[model samples]
Target: MLDAVVVGAGPNGLTAAVELARRGHSVAVFEARDTIGGGARTEELTLPGFRHDPCSAVHPLGAGSPAFKAMPLERHGLEWLHPELPMAHPFPDGTAAVLARSVAETAASLGPRDAATYRRLVAPFQDRWDELVGDFMALPSTALPRDPVTLARFGRLALPPATWLMRRFRDDRARALFAGLVAHVIAPLGGVGTSGVGLVFALAAHAGGWPMPRGGSQAIADALAGLLREHGGTVHTGYEVKRLDDLPPARAYVFDTSPSAVARIAGLGGFYAGYRYGAAAFKIDYALDGPVPWTAKEARTAGTVQVGSSSREIAAALDAVSRYDRAPDVPFLITAQPSLVDPGRAPAGKHVFWAYGHVPHGWTGDLTDAVERQLERFAPGFRDLVLARATAGPPELAARNANYVGGDIACGAAAGLQLLLRPRLTRSPYTTPHPAVFLCSSATPPGPGVHGMSGHNAAKEVWRHLRARP
Candidate 1:
C-alpha cells in the first residue's frame, strides 16, 4: 500500500525512503534489527557508560557526504566532532606523520624532503574541493565531469597500485602515511585501484577533516530515521523481510542488505551470487582509564592513528589478508580516539578507543593480542590504560550486521572492476531484471563508506521509472 518499500533501515535504506518521500511518494522502511545504522551503529559494547561504534567510527565520507549534506540532519540532531588533526601514522622510531586540516601543516608533518611532493599530490583539487568532490563521490559516469582535466589527472594517479603510488616518495614516513590511508580500502596494497582508494581518503581528509558524530555514530542513524519520519515515511524496527512476499504491497522495492542476502531472497542465481566480498575486520573497543600513551606527539592529537611501521610492512600484512587467508603477526591498525574530541562518549575521567584490522574473508582468527601488541608498540603502557575490552572477530561482526558479510565492512569489494560494476556489470547496476525491485546498498557504485550515494542513486532511478508509469 506504499509507493516504495525499503528493506533494511541502514543509511542507504533510510536515505532511499527519505528521497522517495521527498518526491511526493509514500514510503516505508523495515529493519531486521531493533536499531538502525548497519555499519554506523554504536553501543556500549565494552562496559556500561562507554559508548563505542560497533563498526564505523570515523567519518571522512560522512562529513563529506553529499546525500547527508542534502538532508536536514542538523535539525534532526547530528553534530560532527573533528579532532585537532585528522590522522597520524607512527613509525618504530618514536616519530609520527600527521594529516591535518591544512595541507601545508600536513606536509610539514610528513617531513621536509617529502613536503613538496605531498603538497603537489593533494593540492590539485584543494582549491576546488567543493566542485570536485560531488563528481568523485557519485557513481562513475560516462558523461563529462564538471572538471574533466582534474578528473583525468586524478584517475591517472588513482589507477595504479598503492605501492607504486607511494614509490614516488623517498621518505618512509610519507610512504607509510599514504599506505595507511590505502589500507582502509580493505584490499591488498599492490592491488590495482588501491592507489585510488588511498588518494580519495587523503583528499577527503584534507577537504573535510575526518570527524565523528558528537555522541556516537548512532546519532547518524537516529538523525536519518528522524528525518525519514518527518517526511511522512514510516520505519518499522524489528521487522525482517525475507522476501518480496513478506512486504506490504508497494510499486517499488529497494534493498539495502548485502548482495548475498538479495541473491538468496530474490533467487538471482549467478549475478548476485558471484559478487565477491573483500577482506573482513576484527574489531576491538576499549574503555580506557586515560588516553593512549602514544610515544609520538602527533598520535596524541590525531583522531585516527594508523599503527603500521612502514609501507613495506603494511603491504606484507595486507598481502597476508588478501592471499594467505591468515592473520598477520603485526597487523595494520586503524584506530579512533573519540574521547579526544567528544569527552561525553565515556564516563567522567574515562575514554573510549575504537580500532579494527583487516582479516581474510570468513576466516575466524583471534587478533586481540595482536591488536594490543601493535597498540603497545606505538603507545607504551597501552595495556595498563584499558579498563575493559570488547572484541568482534569476523563471525561476530558479520552476525551483528548482515551487511558486513564475513566482516567485510565496506559492504562489497572495491577492487579492480568490482569498484564500478558491483553486484553485476549491468547498465543499470541499481535496478535488477525486475523493474519493480532495485539493489540500493553499498554493493553499487561510489563503493562503500557511511555516505548514502548508493541509496540516493537507486531512488532516483526508481523514481524515474515509476514516474513514467501511467
Candidate 2:
C-alpha cells in the first residue's frame, strides 16, 4: 500500500502529493483525465499555434498563494508576467477603468473621494497581505492571523456586503472594478461573506499585481507535476475511481473532487454524511480570434476585463444567478485576453479571448450564442474574431472532473454558512469521517482558485497523523 493516494492531479492534488513525497512517503496521484492540471490547462483550440487556457486564465491567486510561493514556480519555468494595467473595466461609451500595477494609479483615476476610499479600504489589508492571503487560502482551521494589525485588516474588508461597501465609494469606475473582482465570489454580490471576495482580489491586484504565466496556466500545473515526479510521486492519468474499491490501496486517500463525487466514490460511509448538496454549477468558456477590440483604449492593455457596465448591472446579474437562472441578455462576464500579456499565446497579431459568466446549478443550456452575443455588445464585430468556440456545459464539465459537480468550478459554494465550515470546521479541514481519507480540493475551505494551500494544508494534517501512528 502506498503511503498516500491523491485522487486528481489538479493543483491541490499535486501540491498534496509533493508535500507527502517530500516528507519521505510513497505517494501516487490518480487523475481522471489523460492530461493533468484540472482547471489550469492550455490547449490549441481556436487555431494552430494559438494556445488558449481552457478554464482559468489570469490567476491573481497564483501570484499571491503561499503554497505556490513556497514552491518557487519561478524556478520551474513559470514566468510571472504582469500587465501595465492589472485589469480594465470598459464602459459602453468607450471610456475605461484601468487598474494599474500601482494602487495609487488605479485609485487616483477614480477621482478624489474614490481615491481616498479605495486607499482606506485596501490600506489596512496592505501590510498583512501575506497573512490575509494565507487565512483566505488555507483550509479554515488553519489559524487566522493572531496579529492585531492583520486581524483588523481582515475584518475591515470582510465584514460587509459588497453592495454596502460599493455605496461608500463616490466614483462609479472604482466601484465597478472592485465589484468585478468580487463577482468571482460565485455568490450573490450583496450576499453574506461575499464582500471578502472583493477585498481579497483587490488587495492581491495591488500587492502581487495579478501575474499570468508567460506560456499559459498549464506551466504552473506542469511545474507542480514535475515537482511531484521529482519527489518520487507517480501520477496516473485516465484512471477514474468510481468507488473506493477502484482505487489502489493506500494508507491515506485524498480526493481532489466535489462533495457529491466524494459521497459516490466512498459510499457516504459516514464520511460526508452531514454536508448538503445544493452547489450552483455553471457553463463557461470563451473563444475568440485577434483582440477583443474594445472601444476603450485601456481595455487592450488590461489582462482582465469586467464586462458589466454598472455595479447594479453586475449585482442584478448575480441576483439572477442566486435565483438559479441565467442572467438576462448581458450577463456579468470576467473576460481575459491573455495574448495581450503573453504574445506567445497567439500567432503574430491574432489573439485569444477567454470569458465565463455566472449560471444556475446543473444548468444544461448551450450558452455559445448567448455568450457570443453578450461579447458583441461590448466588442463590436466580435463574431468576426471567432475562429472557433468550445462550450463546456455544466454536465460536460462535471463529467470531466467530478470535483466540479454540475460544473461548479468551485467544487462547492464559495460563500454563505458554508464559507468557513466547508468540507466542515474541524481543526483539519482535509480529514474526513472515514479513516485516513481526506478532501483537499477547492471543495474545502478557502474554496476554489489555483492556490495550492488546500493541498498543502491537507498534506501537513496527514503528515501529523502519520507521524503519530505507532
Candidate 3:
C-alpha cells in the first residue's frame, strides 16, 4: 500500500507528491487530464509558432515562494527569466506606474506626491521576505513562524481593506496600481485582507521579481514531475477518480482540487455547500505579428501590465462582476507579454500576448471585443498586431479544468473572512472530517497563485498523519 495517494496533478498535487516521496514515503499521483500542470499548462493555442499560457503567465508569487525556494527545482531544469520591469500600470496619458525590482524606482513612478508613502508602506518587511512568506504560507500546527514579530506587523497592515491602504497615497497613480494588485485574486477592492494581497505582490517584485519559466509555465510542472520521479514517486495521467474506490488504498489521500469537487468525489455531501465561488475571468491569448504597441514605454518592456485608467474604474469593474453579476463596460485588464523577455515563446520577431478581464461567475457572453477595446486604450493599435486569437470564457475554462468551477480561477472566493480562512472555517484547513483525507488546493490558506506552498503545507500534515498511524 502506498503511504499517500494524491488526486489531481496540479502544482499543489504534484508538490505534495514530491514532498512525500522525498521524505521516504511511497507516493503516487493520478491526473484526469493526459498531461499535468493544471493552470500552469502551456500550448500553441493560436498560431503554431505562438506558444501561450492559457492560464498563468507572469508569476510573482511563484518566483518568491518559500516552498519552491526550499526545493532543488533549479537542478531539475527550472530556469526563471525576469523582465526589464516586473509589472506596470499604464494610464491614458501615456505615463505608467511600475513595480520594478528597486523600491525607489517603483515609488518614483507613482509620482513625487506618494513616493514617500509607498516607501514607508513597504519599509518594515522589505528585506525579510523569507521569514514573512514562510510564516504567512504555513499553518500554525504544521510549522512555527521563523519571525513572529515581523509576521504580526505585516498582518496588522495587511488585514484591512485595500481601500484604507490606498488612502495613504495622495495621488491616484499609486492607488490605481495597488488596486490592480488586489484585483489579481478577483476580490473586491474593499474586501478584508485585500491590503495584504496587494502588498504581497509589490513586495514580491522587489524581492525575487515576477519571473516566468524560461520556455513557458509548463517547465515548472515538468520540473516538479521530474523531481517526483527521481524520488520514486509515480504519476499516472489520463486517470480520473470519481470516488474513493477509484484510487488504490493508501494511508492518506491528499486532494488538490476545489472544495465542491472534493465533497462530490469523496462522498461528503453538502460539506462544501457554503463554499462560495467568486467572479470568473474572460481570458484571451493572441499571436501577434509584433510586440504590443504601448503608449507608455514602460509597459512595452514589463512582463505584466495592468490596463485600467484609474482606481475608481478598477473598483467599479471588479464591483460589476462580483456584485452586479454583469460585465464591465470598460473591463479592467491584466495582460502579460512573455515574448518581450523570452523570445523562444514565439517565432523570429513575432510575439505572443494574453489579456483577461473579470466577469460574473458562469458568464457565457463573448468578452473579446471588450477586452481588445481595453487593450487599445493603453496599447494603441493592439488589434492591428494580432495575427490570431483564442478566447476562453467561464464555460470553456470549466470544461478545460474541473477545479475552475464557474471559471473562478483562484479556485474559491477570496472575499470576507473566507479570504483568511478558506475551504472551511477550521484552524487546520488541510484536514477533512475523514481522518485520512486532506485538501491542499488553492482553495486553502495563502489563497491562490502559482506558488506551490498549498501543496507544501498539505504534505506536512499528510506525513504527520502517516507517522501517527504506525
Candidate 4:
C-alpha cells in the first residue's frame, strides 16, 4: 500500500506529495481537474495569444516561502521574473507610493511626513526573512522557531487591527498604501491580525520581491509536479475523489481542500459546519493591445498596483463587502500587469493584465463595468487598450476551483481568531478527528497566498503519523 494519498493537485497538495516522496515514502496524488496548479494555473481565457493567470499572477509570498525555498523547484524549470518595482499604490493626482525592493525607496515614496514611521515599522525584522518566515509559517507542533525573539516582536506589532496600525502613519499616502495591503486577503481593516497581513506583504516585497514566473504562474505548479515525479510520486489527473472510498488505500490521507470538502469527502459530517466563508472576489483578465496606461509612471512599471484614492475609500470598500454584504460603489482594486516584465505572456507588443475587487459572498452580479471604471480612475483610457476580457464572479470562481467556496479566494475567512488559528482552534490544525486524514489547504494556518507552506507543514504531520503506525 502507498504510504500516503493526497487528494487535489493544488500547490499545497502537490507540495505535500513531493515532501512525502522525498522522505522515502510511496505517494500518489489524485486531481479532479485534467491539469494541476489549482489557484496557480494559467490559460488563454481572453485571446489565444494572451495567456492569463485566472487566479494568482504576482507572487510575493511564494518567492519568500520557506517551504518552497527548501525544495529544488528551480532545477525543475521554475524561474522568477521581477518587475521594476514590486508594487505601487497610485493616487488620482498621478503620484504613487511604491513598495520597492529597497526600504529607503519605499519610505521615500511615502514622503517625509511618514518616511521614518514606515522605516521604523519594518526595521525590527529587516534582513531576518529566513528565520521570520520560517517561524511565521510553521506551527509550534510541526517546527520550533529558528528565531523566537524576532517572531515575538513581529507578532506584537502584527496582531492589532490595521486601523490601529494605520494610526501610526501621519499622512494619508502611507495609510492608503498599507490599507491596500491589508485588503489583499479580503479582510476588513478593523479585523484582528489584519495589520499582520499588510506588514507581511510589505516585508515580503523588501526581502524577495513580488515576482511572476518567466512564462506564467503555471510554471510554479509544473515544477512541483515534475519534482514529485522525479521522486517517484505519481499524479493522476481528471480523477475526482467524491468520497474516501474513491481514493486508493494509504497509510495517510492529506486533503488540500476546504474544511467542508474534507468533512464531506471523508464522511466527518458537520465537522466543519461552523467554518465561515467570507467575501468573494470579482476578477477580470484582459488581453490588451498594449500596456495599461497609468497616470502614475510607477504603476506602469510595477508588477502589482493598488487602485484606491484614499485610506478611507479602501476601508469603506472592504467594509461594504465584508459587513454590508453588497458591492461597493467604488471598489478598491488589486491589479497586476505581468506582461510588463514577462513579455512571453503575450504575443509581440500585446499584454495580459489581471484585476479583482471584493464582493459579497456568492455574489453573481457583473463587476466588469465597476472593475474597468476603477482601472480607468488610476489608468486613464484603460478600456481603450483591451482587445478582449474574461470575467469571473463568485459562482464562476467556485465552479473552476472547489476550494474557492462562494468565491472566497483565500479559501476561508481570514478574520478574527480564525486568521491565525484556522480550520479550528487546535495547535495541530493539519490533523483531523480521523487519525489518518490531514488537511493542507490555504484554509489552514499562515492563511492564503501561493506559498506552499500549508502543504509543507501538513506533510510533516502525515510522515510522523505514518512512522508512528509502524
Taken over the whole model, the C-alpha lDDT of each candidate is 0.86, 0.77, 0.92, 0.93
Q: Runs in model 2 with CA error above 4 Å?
A: 143-148, 270-289
lDDT of 1 by residue, 1-470 (tens): 78999999888888888989988899999999998888888898889999999988898988887789999999999999999989989887898888888888889988889999889888887877765767776645523478878878888887888888887788899998888888887777777778888888887888898999999988998999898889899989898777788899989989998887877676666567678888889999999999999999889989999999988888888888888888888899999999899999999989999888888898786899989899888899999989999999889988999998888888887666786577777777888867788888988877788888788888888888788873
**TM-score winner between candidates 2 and 3:** 3
Give one digit per residue, the lDDT tens place, for model 4 in 32-92. 9999999999999988888999999989999888888888999999999999999999999
How would you encode candidate 3's per-residue C-alpha lDDT over 49-128 as one tens digit per residue? 88899899888989778878878999898999999999999999999999999999999999999999999999898999
Q: What is the lDDT of residue 151 in candidate 3?
A: 93
Where's the lowest-lDDT run of ten residues in candidate 1?
Answer: 135-144
Q: Give the number of colliding residue pairs in candidate 2.
A: 2
The 10 consecutive residues of candidate 2 with the worst lDDT sum are 277-286
- Once fitted onto the true fold, the runs of candidate 4 whose alpha carbons sit more than 4 angstroms away are none
| Candidate 4 structure, TM-score to reference | 0.99
Give the lDDT of residue 323 in candidate 1: 83
Model 4: pairs clashing at backbone N, Cα or C within 3 Å? none
The local lDDT score (0 to 100) that residue 48 gets in candidate 3 is 88
In model 3, the Cα lDDT at residue 441 comes to 94
Ten residues in a row with the worst lDDT in model 3? 136-145
